[model samples]
Target: MDGTVVTDRTAETVGADGTAGRDALNAAAAASAAEGSRSEALRTLSRVFGYDTFRGEQQAVIDHVVDGGDAVVLMPTGGGKSLCYQIPALVRPGTGVVVSPLIALMQDQVDALRALGVRAGFINSTQDFEERRLVEAEFVAGELDILYLAPERLRMQGTLDLLSRGTVSVFAIDEAHCVAQWGHDFRPDYLALAVLGERWPDVPRIALTATATPATHREITERLGLPEARHFEASFDRPNIQYRIVGKDDPKKQLLRFLREEHEGDAGIVYCLSRNSVEKTAEFLERNGVPAVPYHAGLDGGTRARHQSRFLREEGLVVVATIAFGMGIDKPDVRFVAHLDLPKSVEGYYQETGRAGRDGLPSTAWMAYGLQDVVQQRKLIQSGEGDEAFRRRAASHLDAMLALCETVQCRRAQLLAYFGQEASGQKCGNCDTCLTAPETWDGTVAAQKVLSTVVRLQRERGQKFGTGQIVDILLGRKTAKVIQFDHDQLSVFGIGDDLSEAEWRGVVRQLLAQGLASVEGEYGTLVLTDASATVLGREREVLMRKEPKRPAGRPKSERTAKGERKQAVDLPEEALPVFEALRAWRADQSREQGVPAYVIFHDATLREIALSLPADLTQLAQLPGLGEKKLANYGEAVLKVLADHGRLEAGTALEDDSSSSGAESPSGD
Candidate 1:
């Protein structure tokens, strides 16, 4: 019974009173065993990881898995998805085998677990032969509580045979959404994971992901052969993140300004669409005094790993990257996630933005969306390598994203609805639309004018044009392209003189979003859809969100002056120095230990420590996130810091102006 689940066959035996007495006895024994196991799990959680109670659906999910039940858990980032399996693995017998997608982050994951005094190890291609041998020996000897392996490793016979020699308590499939064939981040190797259940029917399995739509959820269940597994769907809403999308205007400059004004010196990620864009944006931010690094598949693996390591270990560093950057990132203090380009789909957008505010503090999800983004995305989908059905699915995803961008309603509401969840209210008061509602006006004439220009280019000129040329022809601009094509002679020319270039682009973009227009070919030439006829015939009235006269500024409620972003956190003035001192101490510990700072102590834990000003180890143990092991390891050091800070406060004012700087933002690691 060494943590291994053993089924009781006593119910199969019949007594003199038939099977009733035996069945009742079996039921009582099973119930008592389950209760005992749950109590052990709770103790393990507190003693190893700190945390008096489980969060959200953690206890239920863990209990079911501990009792030998398969489960599919869909929880948001920083929602403690790891504990759902971690606790059970500790409560049950043998080692927890975690199937991870990010081989590079395995070291950090295992390091974090080890810091909690849990015996954790990982075997991946990155490990040398000696390292793999040591971990394998540990697992076989039952010295390791958890063992992590890449999903691809499961296909190797050697790896499979190695697992057979050790008792596996549970199989945890992390980043489980990768099983979806058409998901935003699909890995071909994940499809092979269905073998775990086939091979070991007695061991419980749990598939966990931070992002997945209803369709992706079904795909995961079907592909992973977990139809009978209990599904635990938590709310996808991350209320701590404020969502904002502004029309692109000199996008690089716009991004620089946004960083300077809102997230100066904050730890964040800026996502671009191309490798070139990632490099250029990183350079621009560095030039403008925003410390940023570039990350994409184009970069060397070592460089990418170095940058990721720096972003994880350092504070107030931004990593400008393509979609390849964040998948299983466990950093808890990232303040914002900015998008320099529009994501191709809502799922991708949601997943990327979800990387921010993982610690549940206030953060932002900003994007510099533009008409060109819409056009470029459409062009990519049309020219992408996929079947008609794939293209249709891609188009549908894009439409949902575009709808979210253009919606006058609550952005969070629309996003939640896309994932098949309803919002609690119409206005969340945390998004750009709710903060400063945009005006939606009738654009029937504008839509008709733009559509007529497309018609004139096709019918009269017998040529197609992109948005720039179409916009020029409507504005009656005598540019070289227009004069070369003699586009000014058309009847539609000069009819749109009332609108500026930006306004015209907005009209075209909205039309495309509403399906009144379509983009075709590699050039992104405008084309009319069947829906255009009604608008041109005055039979349909188009409602469009009016573009603000300028890019919308930060909401007044959340706005702060340059280098004052830390004011958003409602900490007392006296506790600021203590928090900064703890951060400094933690930073030193991280650098000395060669692990991420958050692994030593998350910002949330430090903030609580500062607020409570724990006088001794006993008081410190009462706080959240401080398990028995962490207290024994660092509890005295924390108490010493508090004592020293108290003495300094008693003697002097402790007026450290640098403590309030932007680099010390509330969410800094």
Candidate 2:
């Protein structure tokens, strides 16, 4: 929001220069509400909700559905895809039936909508008979604008019968990619959604998903029977979320440092590869003065529920979890999403990292990627219970993900290209690649040394060893295993003594990524691939990114100094107090209403209100996010806050109030 000037050059794409290319979200949302000559939609967005403009293709998609046409929306996670269908549902004739995948997601959306004074409700397994019956009665009575149903419930004949009895305006299928078997978050129940095209031939259908490759995209269209729906695929770029992939050194300490240096007293999610890692990371964080809770399928149902509730309802509490957590997480204020291990695929990485900065604020997606991740992922692909085709597909996905980690080009461009979208420009000032350009060295000699050693060990000695063993032999480490194999007698032994162990590791990892070598058999032995010949013969120059030095096993020196870190919010000092006061009020209101804090207001909205420093309802109502319901509901209280803070200025910048309790160490709820 505070970036330099960038005028709108393309309407469908969100440019890398931040919000400059787009109108204010609320303003766009409000203007979008005026779809028809006399748009109730525009009023709903500004008054009931708030906002004045639409983002990317949101207005087009909304208008398509409102005009009684099917649609497919492929926008990024934080790109406001929900508004595409939500606005249309309000403006169109009857209630919209939304088939959602998860109960948590459904509830979160329902709560946020109700907070806006929109007649939204959901019926899921989480609700009892009475709760479901009340929502059903509302639908039958035409008292609801949107009804969210789990895909499983929507698949049932009883639910279909109920829908048939009511006046349904549109059928909205969310998380549409889940229909594809190749998708990482596949849901079998989603396949039944295809019947919607047959059963509700006249009802306009809108299918939406945040993550989908060309392959996954086709599967979704074919499986959902929406091949003819007007497609609105917005650029899948989150420039506000900075991407950084660091080599694994001490993961816990590295994660701790990230928290202290860049994300102090902010909400975030930490992902680990295993249940054990989740538990250990949570415990480690708590012990080291960062509040955290563990969430995994292995945890008891009640415990998991409580932890998730705490993570959502409480501010600045980190949730350390395995892949078992975080899909369709509606938390909008997460400042960072850290990965202690490499995700299995690029789709998974994109979806997980997209979870941060959903509120359109600056956030970080930090990962400690390394060689162990590569080995484990390969083992997973090879050991799958499915047939060879499935294994091959899984391996292909893993290779694509690895290439992304190893790419020398702009990370955002490569990532966008992976999704069949061309980035407007290169060098997005966000990712580690663009921010701190890593110097590349000609790795021809290093590649030759590793490839020759592997060949000699296999052809001359009839031995195939893992990467570590090969490195040990080359570094002249005559350990018991090396002595047993008599690998020390080889000509290539000690040839790689010129590079540090970490540097050699870089060469080895890059070789595996580039397909110059491959892991073979159950022993995980490394062998040269056909591609190795070019690098070994000097026909092609191997290039590698210089891996940064890993700090020695000491925590203190590893912590980046406080002054070097960037401040997340850039606002005037005068607005700082008002921002904290608003946050305090929001917390109180959320607790009173028994809803998540974000449901009442997003941090970005609060930041805007704080910086504007509007002294009364008229001025406050004009603020970007103060929708009709929000203004009528909280305008007086907000005015009281500004009045209490003395005379307000119009152009005050936003500053963080460091004195707030948010900066304190955790005393768990």
Candidate 3:
């Protein structure tokens, strides 16, 4: 027998109208049955979620778990990872227990599930004793289809005992990368989750994460004690997100310009390295007419929560934050994610940037990188709290990120390659390098000059200097520091005057990236590496990317122009007004319900509805995402909006009301 079985008892509950109540359906689907069948799963999916079919590996994953098999799934963000466990939980008997790291988002998660008419409940620190007791009662009685618990809750004997009392259908560990002890988002509590298998040997477990490299994938399997589980790794490519990195030149100004020219009035995120930077960036954006808020660990928990809530519930609000923000964000319409500072690793960068365009709309992942970013990151790793092996691992991660930044090939290809996936083509035509290729020049002499300077300073003067002093000496600026250090007297000094200061910095940056030099100590002073000898001996040639010149009043790159146009082109001109009207309606509903707008209906769904111009509830039900509950709840309202628009198009004047769809467009497009 399969793990899940829908019994004839459930079918007997159907009324003469051929419709079962929400409770009856949820109970029949979530509780014990005679067998688990794919046909039943499809029926439940269409009836509850309104999707005709599963996407990618969703069907295979669901089948394996429904048949009492464990799984470790690595699907990209926006890749329908939730449905992998969600469908099986509903198909199988008893409540599906989800161990999630996102305690802050449990309410919203449960709310979304409930909106689908699935009986979902949660137990977390946020709930009062009475509220938790009620949920516990629901679970014990098998009245809940799904039960969400934070990973930390599992460590409690009470939580374990409560689970033993209930008939658990399956166990899902979300954000499973948290078990990777060395991962960017490691949660120490996740190490305790392996006990789930020990406690409930028969219950199938599924571990899911949005981002994980091969090593992290193995680590999650080992840590979760799912070594024999079926592993499903989906392509990590988020093709909707266009990746672009620019050489940092007055990065704040560059960011402001990017926002103004391309993504004005759009919701996005700006990441900085420090809390102070986060605050200042948010303030700067606000002052410059961009509605922005700061979020970081420095802020109180309430402030952080409030800002996060605002970012979610309100449209076109940018959240400036440190790395603390964006792990498990479910907002689907973020237009961009800008990094003012370099991220630490390809994995971290990929995960952070993946937050954008979760709705599968055209979005951007932009970053401003420079020589200082490389230096600062190296210095942090050197002085960071870790042993030698940890520092080496950190350095390896940084090296991969730097390589992505310095690559002349397609950015998307390099990113995919880092995760052990191959791109379909050499050029994705969506990234900066593919759209506007940068020029590569031989910088062998430049590399030699920089290395020689380091050698002269260390050997002759027994001293070292940071990148600035080195550039000053190379350009022969003869600044006060140069005069004080008597650096101008060295033979290697002034030899690099042929290149501009910016160009020399590029050389130094590339040299460090190429392992020709290293940053040492607190001052970030440059020192020659073993590879420097090969370059100095003329045995190796250095190929460096020339920084593209951006003069004043320059035109925006074709990539940015195309991204802007792509968003506009998604909706036909005739259907745009209808889409806007539907969006306005959605915003009002979300505000009333205290949930994010997408939780009601995604912009994609609205766009389809507008294009199709569904005339009635029957027609609306034919559209994707209009699940049974959503159709019943909002179908009449949607049809009414279409009817009003139709009348308005025919020039039939209607009475204006406060809830009129004539209000300004809520999406800010």
Which structure among the candidates has the greatest TM-score?
1
Query: 160-209, model 2: which lDDT tens digit per residue?
Result: 99998899988999889889898888899998888888998999999999
Where model 2 places Cα greater than 4 Å from the true spot, the runs are 1-38, 550-566, 647-669
Off by over 4 Å in 1: 1-18, 653-669
With a 3 Å backbone cut-off (N, CA, C), the pairs that clash in candidate 1 are 3-93, 50-627
TM of each candidate vs. truth: 0.95, 0.88, 0.91
> In candidate 3, what are the lDDT values of residues 1-669, reduced to their tens digit?
222334455466777775674556676655434234677788888999999999899989998899899999999999999998888889998999999988888888888888989999999999899999999999999999999999999999999999999999999999999999889999999999999998898999999998898999999999999978999988999999989898889888888988887788789999999999898998889999989999999999999999999998898899999999988889889889999999999999999999999889888899999999999999999898989999999999999999999999999999989888999999998888887778999999999888888888999999988999988998888899999989989897788878998889989999989889999999999998888899999999999999676722113554345234335428767788888888899999999999988889887889889889987788889999989999999999999999998999776434554236547556544
Q: What RMSD value applies to candidate 1?
A: 6.2
Better of 1 and 2 by lDDT: 1
lDDT of 3 at 222: 97
Least accurate 10 contiguous residues by lDDT in model 2: 1-10
How many clashes show up per model?
2, 20, 2
Order the numbered candidates by TM-score, best leading: 1, 3, 2
Worst 10 residues of 1 by lDDT: 1-10
Q: Please tell me which model should have the higher TM-score, number 2 or number 3.
A: 3
Error of 3 at 206 (Å): 0.4
